[model samples]
Target: MSLTLQDVKRVATLARIAVNDEEAATYQQHLNGIFGLIAEMQAVDTTGIEPMSHAQDLSQRLRDDVVTESNQRDKFQAIAPQVAGGLYLVPQVIE
Candidate 1:
């Protein structure tokens, strides 16, 4: 998984990046080092290992679902600007 200056330049062009010659050379070496590290990681064997989402096996405690509502329709609707037949009224927008 070695990367060259030409490969770096192509990648930069595909990503819409403007890289100079000097920066391309520097980025080529840096990318090569990163690929080398990834290759090293690939050499390790991970047999019979289970994927984990979190480090601790903690359960999520949730509150119980219950119907608890305040039935104060008349008291709340009293502050509306306009009300007719026990309902709030608003401006009609459509023609």
Candidate 2:
């Protein structure tokens, strides 16, 4: 896959980026190189390969699901300007 100077200029215009002739040519070469790498990757055969979540074999360590702190809802609600039915009240702005 290859990209032309015109194609690079058009892409730059669409992206709202300023590009001179020299920069456009450079970008065209870079884009063509990236497309060539993608083409090479697509040429590989992986018929029996299984998809992996991670490249290396590893497992996440988890802690025990137990309460570590006591409830302090009453203490917090005591300091609020307004609270009703264990919920804080705020002025409604929308109609």
Candidate 3:
């Protein structure tokens, strides 16, 4: 499938984009080229090809999950103005 100048104009109008004739023509050419590439890609047979997640094979380097900091919640909550049932109370700002 290819895009005509009229198609480009109509799409631009629907999208509320301000595009002049020259820009619309350029967009039409670029979109038609993309469609041509898609058509060419679809024409190739890949019946026996397995789908790949990425172009290059790579593995994620990860570190071991470990607790590095001691619990400081009790010390912080002791300085707050309101504390109830192990939770900080705040003023209701909304109804």
Which candidate would rank higher by lDDT, 1 or 2?
2
lDDT tens digits, residues 1-95, model 3? 98889999999999999999999999999999999999999999999989999998888999999999999999989999999998999999999
Which sections of candidate 1 miss by over 4 Å? 70-95
| Model 1 lDDT at residue 60 | 96
How many clashes in each candidate?
0, 0, 0
Clashes of 1: 0
Question: Order of all candidates by TM-score, from best down to worst?
Answer: 2, 3, 1
Candidate 2, 1-95: lDDT as tens digits: 68889999999999999999999999998999999999999999988999899999899999999999999999999999999998999999998
TM-score pick, better of 1 and 2: 2
Candidate 2: where are CA atoms >4 Å away? 74-83, 89-95
Candidate 3 pairs with clashing backbones: none
Each model's lDDT: 0.91, 0.95, 0.95
lDDT of candidate model 1 versus the reference: 0.91
Better by TM-score, candidate 3 or 2:
2
Q: Pick the candidate with the highest TM-score.
A: 2
Report the alpha-carbon TM-score of model 3 versus the true structure. 0.71
Cα deviation of 69, candidate 1, in Å: 3.4
